[model samples]
Target: MSIPSFLKLVEIQTKVASVIPFLLGTAYTLYRFNSFDLKNFILMFISLIAFDMAVTATNNFYDYKNAKKTYGYNYEIHNVIVRSNLKEKTVLGVIFTLVLVAVICGFILFLNTNVFVLILGGISFVVGLTYSAGPIPISRTPLGETFSGIFMGFVIVFISVYIHIYDENIVKLIYNNGILDISIDIIEIIYIFLISLPAVNGIANIMLANNICDIEDDIENRRYTLPIHIGKENALKLFKVLYYAIYIDLIILVIIKILPIYSLFVLLTIMPVINNIQEFNKKQTKKDTFVLAVKNFVIINIVHVISLGIGAFS
Candidate 1:
């Protein structure tokens, strides 16, 4: 692949879509908690970007392989599959293997060999790989939304937090450092979880919208994704549910003081969400509106992170 073609194959836009929220969440944790160990954070961030790129490359490989088999070498799935210097499957497999090794080494270097981290890493690896590969790809199931919500939202958030704060002596460290000026209580953990909820839901809905756009192709390939299983109209309703639930949860957290009242800055995301919702309602073709909605979704996450960072720092 030429330089421009290689850049296109990486799909920088999609990468930003997947990575910005994780970056925001990581930044927020460091900023609010003052857990700014730059070296470890950089390692974790690199591992995360690698994992994301590898998974995306794997998905592209799978789609390309299947398209080839079905269409006898027609490049109908160019948007889904990146054309490149190497065979898609070979490229994906090599990237996935190398990234998996890097992620393991990264944990060993930056985190202790605790059971929690090990278990979470195993779960994340399985979910991430099976999302686009394996006999029972999660992306092909009715549980796509549910699986994505858990993995991208809860699991990723927990793992990122754990990576940053997973020493056996973390409580002692926090107490000694005088970070947050509070005890390492259940309330703090719950608060972090609450704050992560909006970003999680936003990401899950974004995936749902993307899957909905590809529903026809998925159905033709015998992949029964959530959007196909639920019907597009119902999927739209679920999208609304996901969007509203995040804000509702944020409000509840603020009301109960689990999140600071100033965290209402997150509500600024409402405008983008509403705008995307309106565009989704008006647009007929999934291809026509899918990219627009995804762009708005990325903006929403970016705004959410910025808002939360400001509130936390202020």
Candidate 2:
């Protein structure tokens, strides 16, 4: 396959969904812990981006394989496999190669970090694999948004921060005489959760937007996504709610001093994001309005990460 076909197969443009959150977590770690580990940072970046690519490739591969309609929008234009006339074995080769790279990098990260890295990395690996490849793929179910948001949003952020502060006693495991004990600092975990909300909301809205646009197509394909289950009206409402919820979470974070007062400047970008949301509310089409969700995500999180940087640096 050519480079363009391969990039399309992996949906490389969508990798920003993961990349932004990774930056958010890194910024938060710097702000909260006042420490940085370049080694682990590099490892996490390679692992996270590789896994994200692998998961996207896997999803596309499965989607093409299982699609019911063979001559329409999805088959002809949307799916790269069908569009590019790529061989199945070649696609599988690309997917497996990406996954192998991700796992190796993640394992190296775990060896340098702690048992929590191993445990959480394992969970993320399972979730990413099962998200689009299993008999009952998560993307085909109503839980797609929730799972994607929590894992890509909260879990990635938490793991990013944790790797930097693994020796901080926030969460620890002790094993002796075949018995194990675990400890956690609830306050710190709560802070991390609050800080993760913007990314969570943004990522969830992206998935919701995609589902909303693809509802008819998805239903015809026997993929009962969230929008199909809840109806588009309610799904749009949920999308609006999730976007607005980011500001509320930001307010709480600022009030608690989890984020610097400078971070409140992110509120200035809200109008543009709201505008995008209204446009999306007006029309929900994959080629037309789906990008509004991505625009909103970028509007919110870019300012968010910049605010974090200002807070950390000053």
Candidate 3:
């Protein structure tokens, strides 16, 4: 397949979902620990991107294979594989190559860091691999938001911070005389989780928005996504709630002094986010208002990242 087809196969445009959280994690690590590990960060970035692409490609491949209806658009126009008439073998080959690259980089990162990295990364890999490929794909279940939000949003940010402080005793597993002892710093973990809420909410909202818009098509395709299980009205309520939760989380962070006062500037995103939420509530068209979810995510997280970066320096 050509480069453009390859990109579409992987849904490259959706990668911002992963990139923003990675940046948030990095910025928080710098702000809180005042430490930076260029080598580990680069390795993690490569692995993260590769795995994300692989997951997206796998999702598309499976969707193409399982789709029962084309909605209003032809598969030839909507799916890169059908559109390009690319061989399934070629698409699988690309997916394997991307996964192999991700695994290699992850192994290198593990060698440089510790077992926690391996453990967490392994879990993420398994989840991503199965998200769209197994007998029961996560995307086809009501738990998609929970898994995507926690794993992609919170876990990625946590790992990003942890990689920079692998030796700092935030979390540790020690083996002594054939016994494994696990220790965790609860306070630090809580802070990390709290800081990660915005990302979790944003990512979950993206999936929720997509499901909301695709409810009819998903049902026709037998996908049974969260929106279908919960009904569109409830799902839209959740979409709005998640966005509002971001601001509340940020405010709490600032009040607790976990986040710098500068981070409060992220509040400026509220008006635009609210506007987008209102727009989405008015209409749930995939071609039109679905973009509002993404716009809200970008508006909130970009400002949050920049605010954290400024805090890191000042």
Candidate 4:
């Protein structure tokens, strides 16, 4: 495929979803733990991009494969495979190659770290593949937002931090006589997961917004996503609520002493966030205004990252 087609097929622009949290998590590792594993961080970033590309390609490939012309998902505007004249085998090959490379990178990092990394990475792999490749793909369910949010948001952030501290005493893994014993720092993991909810909510809103805009087309294609089961009005209400919850969770993070107080300054982005939300509230069309959600995602997460940076330096 050509450059533009490949980019669109992979939805390269949305890498911000993964990239932002990777940065935020690395920042947290640097500031709070006073640790930075540049080698693992680099490997993790590469693995992340490769896997993200695989996920996007898998989503687009399946959507194209299952698309119904009766619902107007024709080649002219939908399905990069048809629009770019790429063979089905060619797309599948690319997906396989991307996944293979991602797996290799993950394996190297696991070897450099510990079995804990391997187990956690294995969970991410299962969830990532099931997300789009399963007979009943996660995207077709009401739980798409929750799944996408937790995996892409919290899980990645958790993995990023875990890799930097893989040798820490928080988690223990023992292998004897072919039996594996595993232990984890439950409270620490829970703490990060809770603070990570802001990004989780933001990432989920992106999927939620996309589902809301594509509700009719999705139903015509027999994919009953969140908006379809909940109705557009309720979905929109949930959209607004998720964005607002970011601030609520940020406040909780600070009050709990997990996040530095300076990170509370992220609340300053609320005005623009609400403005974008209102614009999306006015129109939910994919062609016209679905980008409001994407824009909101960038604004909220970037501001949060900056807040963390300030705290890191202070």
Tens-digit lDDT track of model 1 for 229-303:
779899888887888887789789779865556567768878777887878867635547777656666766676
Error of 3 at 199 (Å): 0.8
Candidate 4 weakest lDDT stretch, 10 residues: 69-78
Judged by lDDT relative to the true structure, which candidate is superior, 2 or 4? 2
lDDT of each: 0.66, 0.91, 0.91, 0.86
For residues 1-314, write the lDDT of model 2, one tens digit per residue.
99999899889889888988888989998887898999999999999999999999999999988988777776799899988999999999998899999999999999998988999999999999999988999999999999999999999989989889999999999999999999999999988888888889899999999999998889889999999988999999999999888998898889978899988988997889888888999998988999989888888888898999899999
Q: Which regions in candidate 4 have their CA more than 4 angstroms from the true location? A: 70-75, 177-180
**Residue 272 in candidate 1, Cα distance off native in Å:** 3.0
TM-score of 1: 0.82
Total backbone collisions for each predicted model: 0, 0, 0, 0
lDDT of 1: 0.66
Give the alpha carbon lDDT tens digit for every residue of 90-166 in model 4.
Answer: 89988999999999999999998987888888998888888887899999999899999999899888888888888
lDDT of 3 at 265: 93
How high is the lDDT of residue 39 in model 4?
94
Per-residue lDDT, model 4, residue 288, is 77
